[model samples]
Target: MFGWRRRNRTGRKTGRSKKQQFKLDKESVLPNHFRCPISLDLMKDPVTLSSGITYDRESIEKWLEDGNFTCPVTNQVLRSFDRIPNHILRKMIQEWCQENQNSGVERIPTPKVPVTGTEVYEILSSIEASMKRLDQCGFLESLKKINKWGFESERNRKCIVDNGTATTLANAFVTFSSDDHHQSLESHNYNVLEEILSSLNWMFPLENDARKILGSKPSLNKLVLLMKRRDFLSTKNAILVVEELCYDQEFIEALVGIEEVQEVLVRFIKEPICHAITKASLMVIFSMVSSSNHDHERIKTQFAEMGLVTLVLNMLIDGEKHLNEIALGVFDRILDSKEGREAACGNDLTMPVLVKKILRVSELATEYSVSSIWKLSRIEKQSNEGRVLFEALQVGAFQKLVLLLQCGCGDSTKEKATQLLKLLNPYRAGLECIESSDFKNLKRSF
Candidate 1:
């Protein structure tokens, strides 16, 4: 009886194994036409079937849960869960899940978004279209509006400041000061400048326009009123604006039309402690000086005779290391002109005094003083009174030159010293004096 029971159990196990083998053979027999086109590895994530349909693992699971499991291949609709053949579907799902989990990513479908290229092009095209509509009159009107707005803004800023508002006023004066408007205006197209300037006036005020507003009698009256109040800051701003205007060829021509502009500027220069004002004034003067058509000699004579030489010399004396270059440049300009040269080398006493000052400065070992002295000696017109100049240079000046030569200060300084020595040693005065020294022991030491 035990043998019969064991045989019966073996027979059941054999039948179950045969059924499983049959299902595996059926699945393996399916054609390759059912494969997905994308990966070509087995159909996995969101696999598409031969019926032009795609199903994720979730969709297939839902179909099975609803008792609708079918291959649609053999029309073999499965009834029992046991009859449903496992087709490595779980393996594919496991692989996709592991890939996503390892990468820490989730698959998302792309959303449809509209293109903006055409809209951007349309906006740019509209700007290009409107550029043609800008005419001279329209431009002038726009400029006027700009000027009005600027004036209002300035007034508002002042009002805010008065009321102790936290808003900071725009530094209009500083902006005007810093701008390289002279170069900009010269390079800019005139029509564009006219438009820009007109726009500026409309926004700010006509107070700054030296040609249009300041050139007029009423504007001059208003400026005189502001000037009388000793509002130097505002005066400075006005001068800057005028200087920029003076840089403009057309504006300069208009200024030449009215003698009042020059008169006002000249009067301003005459005032005491007008260094800041003088800077702007000098720009205008320099502009005129640079012109080929202008009579520069007359201006040079005028400035020289007006004590400008003394003022500039005093400036040089007071100027520290930083202003040395400017002072030297000013000295050079003064010495270049005949009137300036005369003023500097004039009074027989001035050259000696200058020579002494140069010696003192050189002894202090200021490079700028040494350089300036070297330059002055080269340009100075020699006279019988050069004896005093020679004496001043001789006392310790030669020692300074030797020191510079030893240090290799510069070729120019060495060359200058050589030239100066040659000048001083006319008729072998220096060499004869040196040879006469009791050098019996000195020669032996060498």
Candidate 2:
């Protein structure tokens, strides 16, 4: 490998740095054929596109991910994006690496074959055939295999979604759910049902059509029950499916009308928290509450009556930074009614938490929290309802609002904070600490 003494411009080996010596020792001059055109490095897992140009799989995948439709070398429109492995070239490269073992060359391991659309179709066909025969165990096993494949690669995920896997699983789940006596299912059949629900949860980009199938009342009840299970991953998946199903007003109202559904979601949002499930539940509620414009007050009234306000308040107090932001966003939307405002102020921790987050968590959280407080102040000013203004004073909300402006919060948050400060000006004397030097200094600054 070091047959010839290669030297720099000075033609002296004594002046070579340790880094250069190391590079020369490990990475000897590679044959041009061994290098990828894109990265100009030793090829690993080389694959060919329809343009017939071979490139490293990682480089080509990154190119495609960047939205390029043409081959790198050919600059030609790709006839197909399917990547075919160059096994002959790969074997040659592996042999060359083995021959150059002293140069620190490592052998490339065999690459996983990219999933094809045809493979996805065959799996779906087998699943359909097995399900028709009432082969519960076989069907469950097939679904599990597909689920495992779906998580392996983005290509497999797309193939599964495009080949009607999600739709089929959703239909099966809906059919099983429509049976009113599912409680009497045999143990194996019950396990199959769980797998079906779990498989449906695995489906990504759950399109509107599949969502429509699962949004049915019966289907929703099944999902809620699945979400209530003790298993974290299974429950998280069920919550994801439920969020996808709440696509519009009718579906949202149907879900909201299910008291147990609301209770379960609220319970998840509040205790023994799984962050993913909590985020999904919050998103589902946001979609449901935001979908209804004409019946928003009534919907918000129902959620408030179900103790959603207190649940969300507790979440805001205990959730992590990102969760706090989403919880605040959902809480802001719910504050469209008197009950929502009263529920917030009734919780002794709400104002304190809102004020505490003014410049904390994130910029998005700051905006949402300020919006929630602003909504409360407006409601209080309009209806002479709760002591929201006094509560703000009690929680140092006024000082926080003033500090918010100086701390470089977003324009919207600063605007809302300004408006809220002005709205609560009438209650300034209610602050017992107003005469203290710190309070006096902040009040003057405001």
Considering every candidate listed, which one attains the maximal lDDT?
2
Residue 143 local lDDT, model 1? 36
- Per-residue alpha-carbon lDDT of candidate 1 for residues 159-276, written as tens digits (9 for 90 to 100): 3223211111112222222232443323222233333333332223233332453444333333333333345655565555455555555445444444344445545545634665
Q: Best-fitting candidate, measured by TM-score?
A: 2
Task: Please list the residue runs of candidate 1 whose C-alpha ends up more than 4 Å from where it truly belongs after superposition.
Answer: 1-231, 242-275, 281-294, 319-324, 347-384, 391-418, 425-446
* lDDT comparing candidate 1 with the true structure: 0.42
Q: Over the stretch 1-446, how does candidate 2's per-residue lDDT look in tens digits?
A: 56356566786455567877777765566778889999988898889899988999889988998999999998999988888999999998999889877776778777677677788788778877776666667777788879888887776777788888888787767666665465442423556667776677656678777778888877777677777677776687778877776666677877776657767777786575667777888888788778645777877777787788877766665567678877888888888877887787677667777777777888888898889988888777778854888877776788877877887876777788889888778888846623112222221100
What CA RMSD would you report for each candidate?
26.9, 6.5
My TM-score estimates for the predictions, one after another, are 0.36, 0.79
Error of 1 at 276 (Å): 3.5
